[model samples]
Target chain A: MVVDKMLYNLGRYVNLLRDAIARPEKFSMYYKETMRQMDAIGVGSVFIVLLISVFIGMVTAVQFVDQLGDSFVPSYYIGYIVRDITIIEMAPTITCLVLAGKVGSNLAAEIGGMRQKEHIDAMEIMGVNTAAYLIMPKIIAAVVVIPMLVAIAAFVSIVGGYVSTVLPGSLSHTEYVLGLRSFFVPRYVFMMFVKAAVFAYLITSVSCYMGYYAKGGSIELGEASTNAVVVSSVLILVFDFLIALLLT
Target chain B: MIRTENITKTFGDNDVLKGISTEFYAGKPNLIIGSSGAGKTVLLKLLIGLFKPTSGKVYYDDVDLFSVDDDALREVRMKLGMLFQGNALFDSMTVGENIRFPMDMFTNRTLGEKEKRVDECLEMVNMEGINDRFPSEVSGGMQKRVGIARAMVLEPKYLFCDEPNSGLDPKTAILIDELICDLTNRNNITTVINTHDMNSVMGIGDNIVLLKDGHLVWQGDKSQVLESEEAVLQDFIFASPFLRRLREDALKQRHAHD
Candidate 1:
């Protein structure tokens, strides 16, 4: 049933895409709206990313050094581990998860409230395509902003790893930077970029769908918002595993 | 300018509108009145093409609403305006922006031109300086005015208002009714209003269609309604306690004089 529903929605999206192409004005407005949405989702989330990333990097580094020690795995390997795991997988996945909580909820609430208040109906009556006016902009913004957020998360986690491993342990600071570059490969970095982009698409589309179908009143809207986050988080993980298997 | 012929709508087993037909004239306030659950709102939705009639046709001028393609239907809708029961103003936008939304969607007007038209519509609704306020920051009456301003922003030839005075106080309801009537006359737009409010029926009911149980029981001007001796009509008309008491007092006075 779920797969069928998803297929139906995909078909609907294709139709909307066609409609958007036909209406240049709606398309232009949708593009502008997407930029505005990116600011709200990506730029506004910086504070949390900074606070969480630094600590995550620091802690992951500590665990690596504490368990392996200077002789066994060498403390330098901590940087490599942080770079690979954090950038290629953890950062993108976790950032989107956080966004599912923040952005997903906000999207659901906003759309649901608008629906409850009949603002969407008003738009339809005015000949404004509500999908183009509302959903397309959010989709555009999410696609643009989610990747940047993943980059920020990657930066923070590396800094955290440094604080956790280098600052606390006997490992020299120079070794940490060297270890990060030692195992660095073009493919891994490419993988991280792909993962970030994929995660961004997953989170935004699911959230928008939740917000779009939210019915009843304001109370139901809140429920829909929470449901959006939960659903997006699960979908993100599922997509993450599938991508990982494919890449491997 | 708006006509529905044998329009019928049903939800599952429950029929909401049962073979209803009505014509709403341009340049006047056309009122649809009924008791709760009498399908007045459903009939209004059918007129506006929000819900496709199950077994009949709704004609906006001569175009059959249900027969059109989606693109054509959307184009037809562009010529329409609606004031929803709850005002339905975009809460994120200021009053001026809300009014300009239709113009933004349907026209290639410059931002300056849009702003000018928004200002003019707001001014016409007597909402002069409140352009910057959000819907949440406005009173019910103010929101209704803003709704009206937004509805007429595109100068649509057809307007549909579903219970414009639903949640307002009596005096506010009167004001909104008058405003709708005035706008209808000024623009020569075909306006259809659905209400259970007696005040609305009397105030701007240039042509009134009374619905009972998803069917059109009667339709006539306000004067014709007053003289209607139908028992169902009387039940609704003299149903008011105050009017009933006044009738009783007048009867007693006549008996004493006799």
Candidate 2:
């Protein structure tokens, strides 16, 4: 029974995306909406992503330094390990996991509120194609902007690694820089972007599906928002593992 | 006119609308009234093609709603407008922006033209100016009027208002009824209103359809309401003792004078 329900919902989610990905009824209207979403999703979320990324780098560097402190491992390996872990796993995965809470919850709440308020119904009556008008712009904006955020996260994490270690004299700046430049594969950067884009699409689309089908009253709407975050968080982790398996 | 041919809808084992057929004439206020859980909303949604009937047809003139393609259905919908019970105004937008949204989506009109149409719609509802205010900044009555303005701004051929006077003072409710009636008459639009407000029932209910237990129980103009012998109609319309007494007294006075 549970598996049947899950399959039914997955089918519905796929259908909703199919409808939402249609060519918009009007280009100008959709363009304006896309710009608005870009401002909301991109410009609005930078600070949180940066702040968290900095701390992620700091924690990884500090822990690795302590772990390797008693061993014969070189101190410069701390910078290399932090850089690799952040780029390969921490940056895209952790940042999007946080966004699944912040941006994901916000998307679900917004669309669900509109559903409860009858805004979606009103738009439907006007022949505005509510799914496309509401969901597509958001998806477009998130996919384009979230990768940029993940890139910023990766860069800042390296800087944070530097600040935490070199400032405290745990390692020299020259050694840390040298470690960062070591074993830098351009393919890893491509993998990071691929993960960021995939995660961005998952969070936005899943959250939107939750919101678009939300019915009943405020309690139901709140449940939709929570479900969006929870579902997106889980999907991000599952995809992260899959991407790792494929790329590595 | 819009016609329904034995429209029936069911949810699982529960029948909400049971093979009901009705006609809504144009250029007048056509009302659908019923007690709570009588399925007025379901019928209204069916009429608007929001819910497909299980085994029947709804025709906007000659076009069978269920038989048409997506583009054709969208064409039919483009000529439609609706005012929700809650107004459904976009909270983040100002009154003018909310009213102008449909035009922004569908028309190639310049900014000046859209603004002019917005002002004209507001004026039609007797709510001129205050376009800069958000929906939260307005009174409930003002919000209803704004909703009416937005619904009519596109000059749609069909207008559906779901409980247009749910939360308002009696006087304002009557005014809103008058405004909707006036708009209907002027535009020659098929205006269907689902409402429980008594003043709206008797004042502007030029064509009323009453449903009970998912069946069309009684239907007539306002003049026939008092004279209606259908117990279900009387029971539902005059459910309150005070209104029943007033109705009886008014009938008695009329008979005495005759």
Candidate 3:
């Protein structure tokens, strides 16, 4: 049943895509609206991202230093580990997970409300291209904003991890900076960016698909939002593994 | 004018509209009346090209709506207007913006011209000076008025209203019915309204279509409705006096709250 529904949803998305391209004027409206939505989701989510990044960095740094000891790997490796983990995996995956919790849920709620009130139907009746006007903007916003957020998460996490590891005498600040710069690979950064962008699409598109189809009233809207977050988050994890395996 | 031939809609095994055929003429309010679950809204959707019939055709003038490509259907839709059951005003936009929405999408009008058109539409619905206020800030009746204004903003050739008076007070509902009727006559637009309100039935139902168990049971004017001795129609009209009074009282309460 789930696979069937997912296929059905994929068909609907294809239809919506066709509708959007067929009407370029509607694409302009979607761009503006999606930017508006992206601001709501990405900008509004900054404080929580900062908090989570800080704690994650502190914990990861402390755990690495304690486990590695002094001889096998120097405490300076803490910064490299933080930078490498964040750039390659932690930052994009965690940021998307958080977005799935925050922005994804909100998208579902907003679109579900529109559906319940017949606002979407009203747009259709007015000869307005609803997919372009409503869904496209969100897709554009997600594609643009998620990478910026992941970058922020990586920078903040490294800084926080440095503070935690170097300040506690496990590693000196000089050694940490040296270890961090010793093996900097641009390929990993590029991969991380690609992951962020793909995850962003997954989060927004799935949330929108669920919300757009939501029927009934407030209760149904709530359920749809919850379902959007859950489904999108799982897809993010699965897609992350596939990307990691392919890149590796 | 709109015409339907052998229009049928089925969900799974349940037939919502069973081979129903009807024609709604231009320049007047053509209403569909039926008991709850009688598929009146389904019929309206089919007429307006929102939902394709399971096995039939809907013709607007000479064009078969279902036969056309999506672009052509959209072009047909551009000439259409609709007032939804919940008033379907965009919550994000204020009254003026909502009214100007259609113009923004399909017209090359300047901002000043759009504003002017918005003002004109608001004035038509007796809604002035609240252009910047969001839908949430307005009363339900006012929201419906804003919806009507938005619908008529395009000067559409075809106007479809589904339960325009559903949530309004008796007075507001009557006012809306009168406005729709007057607008149809003034614009000579083809106006189709789906309603269960007997008051609307008697007030602006220049042409009436009645449905029962997914079939077109009767179609005529108000006089024919009043004079007809159909048992089902009689039962439906008279069986709900208490509910109507309850609704009136609720409408009064809503007005008082607003």
Candidate 4:
């Protein structure tokens, strides 16, 4: 029964996306909505993304340094480990997981509220395609902005490692800088962007689907918001594993 | 004109609208009234093509609503407007922006032209100026009026209102009814309203259809409501004890005069 319900929902979600990508009624209107979403999703999320990313790098640096005690591995391996880990996993995955909670839940609640209030119906009656108008701009904005955020997260996390290590006198600044420059692969950067884009699409689309079909009242809206975050987080982790398996 | 041919709607195991046929004419306030569980809303949604009937068909004049392609259906919908039970005004926008939305989406009108049309619609609803205020800042009656203004801003050929006076004082409810009635007559648009307000029924109900458990049990104008012998109609319209006593007293006084 659970599998059947999941399949049904998956089918419906695909169909909704098909409808959501249709030609917009007016280019100007769609452009305006897209710009608004860019501001909300991109500009509004920078602070939280930066905060979480810095902490992720700090924790990784501190923990790895302690674990390296008496080991033959060079102390500067901490910088190399932090750089590679942030690029390969922490930057895209952790940043998006945070966004799934913040931006994803918010998208679900906003759209669910509109559905409950019949604003979507009002737009439909006006011959404006409601799904396309509401969902497409959000998707577009997220796709464009989330990768940039992940890039910033990657940079900030490396800086955080430097601050935690170099400023604490545990590791020499020259050694940490040497470790940062050592063995950097350009392909890993490519992998990071790919993961960022895929995760961004998953979070926004899943949240939007939850919201678009939300029924009943306030309780249902709350459920939709929670489901959006939960479902998107799970999908991100699952895809993270899959991408790691396929890419590495 | 809009007509439904034995339309039916079912949700899972529950059937909301049974096989029922009805017609709403243009240039009149066609009211649909029923108790809480009746199929009035389902039927209204079917007419607007929001819900596809499980069995039957809905026709906007000669065009079958469900039979048309998406593009064709959208073309038909462009001529339509609706006022929701909760007014459904965009909370983020000012009154002028909300009214200008449909125009902005569908027309190539200049900003000046759109502003002129917005003012005209607000004036038609007797809510001139105050264009910069948000919906939350307005009173309930004013919100309903602004909703009406937004719905009519597109100058649609058909207007559907779901409970236009659901939450309002009795005096304000009558005023809204009169305003809707006046607009319907002036525009000669096909206006269908779903309402449970008795004052609205007797005041502007040019044509009324009553539904009970998805069946069209009664149909008539306001004049026939007082004389209606249909038990369902009487039970619904005079549900309150005070109205029933009033009805009985009026009948007794009429017999005494005779």
User: Which predicted model would earn the best lDDT?
Assistant: 4
lDDT of 1 by residue, A130-228 (tens): 766777677667777877878888988998887766676546789889888887777766677787777776666667667766888767888889888
Candidate 1 on B1-258: residue-level lDDT in tens?
988899889999999888888899999999998889999888887777667778999888899988998778888888898999988887778998889877776788899999999999989889998889998999999999999998888888998999999899999999999999999999999999988888888678899998888988888887665556666665665688887676567667867998
True contacts kept of each: 0.72, 0.77, 0.74, 0.85
In the predicted model 3, the residue pairs found to clash are A34-A137
Query: What tens digits encode model 2's per-residue C-alpha lDDT throughout A45-67?
Result: 99999999999999999899889
Clashing pairs in 4: none
Candidate 2 vs candidate 4: the lDDT winner is 4
**TM-score of chain A, cand. 3:** 0.93
Q: Residues A42-138, candidate 3: write the lDDT tens digits.
A: 7988888888887788888888887887557766677888889888988899989999999999998988889888889988888777777777778
Docking quality class, candidate 4: high
DockQ of each: 0.60, 0.82, 0.55, 0.82
Over the stretch B63-180, how does candidate 2's per-residue lDDT look in tens digits? Answer: 8988998778888998888988899999999999999998998899999999999999999998899899999999999999999999998899999999998988898888989999
**Which residue ranges in model 2 land beyond 4 Å of their true spot?**
B256-258
Across A29-102, the per-residue lDDT of candidate 4 in tens digits comes to: 99999999989989999999999999899889888999995799999899999999999999999999999999
Score residue B2 of candidate 4 by CA lDDT. Answer: 92
* Lowest-sum lDDT 10-residue window in model 1 chain A: A16-25
* Candidate 2 accuracy as lDDT: 0.92
